[model samples]
Target: MSDRQKGLIDALQLVVPQVELRFCARHMHVNFKQKWSGKSFKDVMWKACRAYIKFVFDEAMKEIKDMDESAFNYLMAVDPSHWSRHAFREATKLDCLLNNMCESFNKIILQAKDIPILTTKYIRRLLMKRFLVKQESISQFEGRLVP
Candidate 1:
């Protein structure tokens, strides 16, 4: 995933052609908001990006078009598959729209990330700590799945 860089897209196509590229919706919204900012635009843009059904996505885009063709055109310039859920490959089973989780992981591993060996140890320790904490919660749960 990226912030919608054309160069990165080109590079990925060359290096990993089979990998699906995605845009951080947060970044797309920031760029879109620079030209057009308002409640309607924000709501519609989010609706379009979050829509898993193409029809719902199209309806949102149509609304944007009706409000302002230029705004619609601006969004259309970038392929929907890069930033919208409707175009995402179902096989991936991951519908992440932003890099928040990635950022959080990076933050947690920041200190040892430079050393590949240490990074694994750090992550293992972190996971063990987490599992230990979760044990108490799991014991309290009555269902097969935690509540």
Candidate 2:
């Protein structure tokens, strides 16, 4: 998943043609709010994102259209497959709506990003700490599944 930069999309398509590109719904909403900002729009936008079936998606989109045709047109200009759940492929078995995993990794090693030594040390410490905590947590588990 990505924030849907055209250059990055082109590069990914060129490099890994088989990759299923998905735009981060959260980021899309941020861009969407620049023009259509309100509770109703926000609610319907989320409804569209959470829709796992075509009928539900269509209904949510219809609501958006009824409220404001221009907003619906703007959203429709981009293919639904890129950002909407109803059109997504299930090959990955992962239905991620945001780029939260990548963002969290970036956040963990944040600040002084240009400084290699500091960044490396921060990441190393954070990873080690996480692993240790996970290990300890697993050790206390009496269940069959470690996850």
Candidate 3:
């Protein structure tokens, strides 16, 4: 997470003690690449992120340290629970690294998002129309499954 994001999380944690924060591996990789560039480094970084077992994660970290101690130390300074699958809370059942769905939804609502709060009626009607169109299309499906 960026310094601003970390600050926000820190503040939020004071208010909501139970809030669970997770970082996107894609963003972490991009940040890491900005400092260290190499296909081998990228592969090892991803390997560490994707490791589902502590032993596997440790082994990958060993390889990273062997290749570049600084890179390994950088990763060690960050919380593993935020980036590595091995330390994720089982209750969340979150299996993905990136928030692609949220990003896609933001893109889909880009036009609607620009409407001023004073003119909510126009946005509301637009959203209603969109919802109706989606409902009609969904109703056309003959199978039991919606997808």
What stretches of model 2 exceed 4 Å from their correct place? 111-140, 145-147
lDDT of 3 by residue, 56-82 (tens): 999999999999899999999988888
Off by over 4 Å in 1: 109-143
What's the lDDT for candidate 2?
0.90
| TM-score, per-candidate, Cα-based | 0.75, 0.80, 0.74
For candidate 1, the lDDT comes to: 0.90
Error of 2 at 107 (Å): 1.4
TM-score of 1: 0.75
lDDT of 2 at 40: 98
How many clashes (backbone atoms < 3 Å, residues ≥3 apart in a chain or on different chains) does model 1 have? 0
- Give model 3's TM-score versus the native structure: 0.74
> What tens digits encode model 1's per-residue C-alpha lDDT throughout 1-147?
887666888899999999999888999999999998999999999999999999999999999999999999999998898889999988888998998876777788788878886778889898798888899778878977656
Best by TM-score: 2
lDDT of 3 at 55: 95
